[model samples]
Target: MAAAVAPTDQGPLAGLRIVESTAFIAAPLATMSLAALGAEVIRLDPSEGGLDHQRWPLSQEGASLYWTMLNRGKKSVTLDLRTEEGREAAARLVCEGDGIFVTNLPARGALAPEALLDRRQDVIVVTLDGSPDGATAIDYTVHAACGAAQMAGPAGLDSPVNNAVPFWDVIAGRTLAMGLLAAELERRRTGRGQHVALSLSDIAMETMANVGILPEAELSGEARPRQENWVYGSFGRDFETRCGRRFMLATVTGKQWRALLSATGLGTAMDRIGEAFGAPLDDDAERFRARHAIAALVQDWAGARDLTQIADAFAGTSVCWSPYRDAAQLLAEDARASPRNPMFARQAHPGVPPVLTPRTPLRLSAHPRLAAARAPDLGADTASVLGPLDTAGKEADP
Candidate 1:
């Protein structure tokens, strides 16, 4: 909006424009993802900021790192939607922008999908709600309701263990982006636009169904017991090295299972245990059934060696394993998390110090990936985006 700066890297989504009224995770993430792919995303907020403006994981200067990261590569505009003038201005912007509108906020009155579509018949409106019934819910609530939380913790634990990450919200964000693209494609083909609606709870439930959780629960009339760190239907779990560093090892394929045995020098021991149990350890089901015995031997082998020795042994092998590390350790040790990875770059945002920011993870063979950009200051693009609105909320003549 600020004079339309020339793009250095035009991604596959170049020229696609999106106007968003959103907050928190899913909607913001969806727009940000589109922005990374070269869409011009104009994000609308209240004058003070939206609900997530002050959300946690703040920088030392009290800037919301979460908000900053999610809204990167987007133009920020502020409007007081509670007023009739503000609502009219917002509706005008949505109708004028490449006919695409996205929001997780309530779409009603002037900004409703019906109203926007009436203004421009080809408008593609994407809306995400907590549930189909319009009940309030977030990632944590959806995860808990979908029975995932109950199956997440230690095997013997009495209570449900909630994951720290908001996986459902993340999934919903990507899903919304996909839906928007699909709608856009349809609009292009038929010259008609439609509304794309999604619910966070539906995303969680459908994912559970897709992963066989719902059917298993229905057929067995029971919930899956907590599995701790073990990979389901395979040989995998955590083990501690001699230096007390922990690593997860998983053998999902026969090659990986054989490699695990070979690397740990436990082939004979595993064979003996299989013979005692009257099952071959090579079979996936058998491996899962005899996981305790297999894990014990692997743990003992790992406990006798340091992490470096374990890494050396597994290097260039089919043994799938990784050393556990915290966030600080990931930044310090892992090359993938650093700027060495093509997906990441050190960039400065408005109020925070320069930090590692990421462009879209998706790689397109046809187009170059756009570089990540910092989020704009609140209302930074309001004048350029909306021009000078009159007292009646109409765009004034230039």
Candidate 2:
């Protein structure tokens, strides 16, 4: 049976239980989505708030705004995973919880799930790291080493650029959620569980989307200098504008390509634009360039209009698209964030009003729980979580 909550919760994922022993974006995002959909997610963060708390965009109470943004929709329990006692305590919670997502993106000082799962056999664990084969140094270091920092751009820039966005982590988070759901379904059927691992490098490589990138040669040969706005894995896609605001334009065929023809007066019906969905981009450079030119013209059309009007224009069509948005812009234009009818609950934490956190996105029709209470202070759950563990420790264990 699903875990109990008020039947009025909004999302279909009501009643599932999840725990997060994560460092950064990927794991947090995965668990947050689950929480949005009505899963009970207990976020076990590091004792000192890990590497991000005091870093940037400070809260009034001085916690990192970045930290607040990613941690919505969950309860927090801070513990020292480096110590044996802490590890044991965490494993106990995982056993009680249905699933856990772990991030070793900063491949250093993370609790190893392989070791933790050795102690708890039935709990599902999803491990996220930066490199495919081994541990990563950190988010930036791993991308630097894997040539992602260089490949993030075009070939002319003098140096590599840190991807300001968590592209790898975002998609990997979705993938981790998928893996966990699949495992959860399997566990329900078989009364058994499995480990799911995702590497940030593998994810970055998978998302490169440029047709001309040669990873094997690029990694071993010259550290390819960075290039801005260049893609490597796919051919017929590029950025643009509809009436004025920026947009992404992706086309699949000469037919869908015709949509672009009508939208932007460039390219021909005779253009060889076969988008065999999984075809290699390097082999399709000519096709990409032909599309890129027309796409750039569409960018001009999009350059003058505001994002809202542009979005209204693309309401119907296979003109596959996206609008670039930062959090501030998102808060302003997104109907979900409207004060009159918000999709998420907004809260300013006890000491820091700058810690404006959004509630989980899941909306259940029947049993609707509001938002979780404010994030906890460090060791806030020590008594609650460790009490049973302490009593059991005094009793017995293998």
Candidate 3:
């Protein structure tokens, strides 16, 4: 049974309702974004809290930090969707509201887009799959198939490097949110809803196409090579300071090159190196072509100065540079307990100590701020939302 509907949200999506039948990062993240934007998202989980609720990084008392992070600011209801009664209830919950249904579930089940659309003609059905035909492809597989895995990592590597971050899943999720919002607007304008289908594979391929690497390969008959920390075809490299701090430096223009040389007191060394190469140091293309030589010269200068001295030298220069910070260092210093980083906030949940959880990154000047509350316990809102619907399902089951 469903729980009583919560108070009406007041963001741009205020009064809008979304039924989320999704698991994992992409689908859930899409609904989470909508919820943060003031849509009342009702998440349908299984009797056992579903696969996502069991993902790792649990608390000492077996609470899922991963689930809480993605499912924030939404209502949760557990149902046995494998049964006819449960499927009917799921349809009822979706049909009764704003008629927005978002799911990554397989396209041929009770919760399929056709099933939901059949149940409510005006419902907006947004479904995401691994592929258009529903072949199983998560972000990692899609990333590999889309050529990103081969493009990442350092130069001269025989093997492809997988990024620690699942880039495609995030992109797909954000795109899905945009689609859902667009569908909502269209429905409002025409009083007609539509089915929106998206695939992680397609999303990755389209992004790569726009990125121009594949087009460049087709035109030049050469695949782009990995450049590691250096920007591809740009003047950039990671250098270590005297105190062993690492910094990634880049200079895109001749002025920035001159600024870098002046900032690091390497102008004379650069002039000598340029003379040796028979190239002018002021030409960005020439400097990039001689990047190895210039990098070596700058490394010597940077390696002799501590990070503090480097900062002082770079204070008035436009030689773009930033120190590399690991997760612990970043969290403990800049992102730790800072209001400027609106994505993170302190929240306490059952069976877990208060910890930092991520919130929606979107901020609205005209709407009430979305609260980053803890996710509900499994099936916690079942009675409130599906209460009357559950009874009706049983009464008609005969």
- After superposing candidate 3, which stretches have Cα over 4 Å from the reference? 1-9, 107-110, 252-262, 267-287, 315-319, 336-342, 388-398
Error of 1 at 77 (Å): 1.1
Better of 1 and 3 by lDDT: 1
Better of 1 and 3 by TM-score: 1
Model 2 C-alpha lDDT per residue in residues 43-134, reported as the tens digit of each score: 77676777655667776666776666666656777877667776667777767555454554332222466655565665677877767667
- The candidate, 1 or 2, that scores higher on TM-score is 1
Select the stronger candidate by TM-score from 2 and 3: 3
How many residue pairs clash per model?
Answer: 0, 34, 10
C-alpha TM-scores of all predictions: 0.94, 0.66, 0.88
Which stretches of model 2 miss by more than 4 angstroms?
A: 1-6, 10-17, 45-47, 96-118, 132-135, 145-155, 206-345, 350-374, 391-398
Candidate with maximal TM-score: 1
TM-score of 3: 0.88
User: Model 1: per-residue lDDT, tens digit, 54-76?
Assistant: 89999999999999999999999
Lowest-lDDT window of 10 residues in candidate 3?
2-11
Computed on alpha carbons, the lDDT of every model, listed in order, comes to: 0.89, 0.61, 0.81
Sorted by TM-score (best first), the order is 1, 3, 2
Give the per-residue lDDT of model 3 (tens digit) for 200-243.
99998898889898798889998878777766665889999999
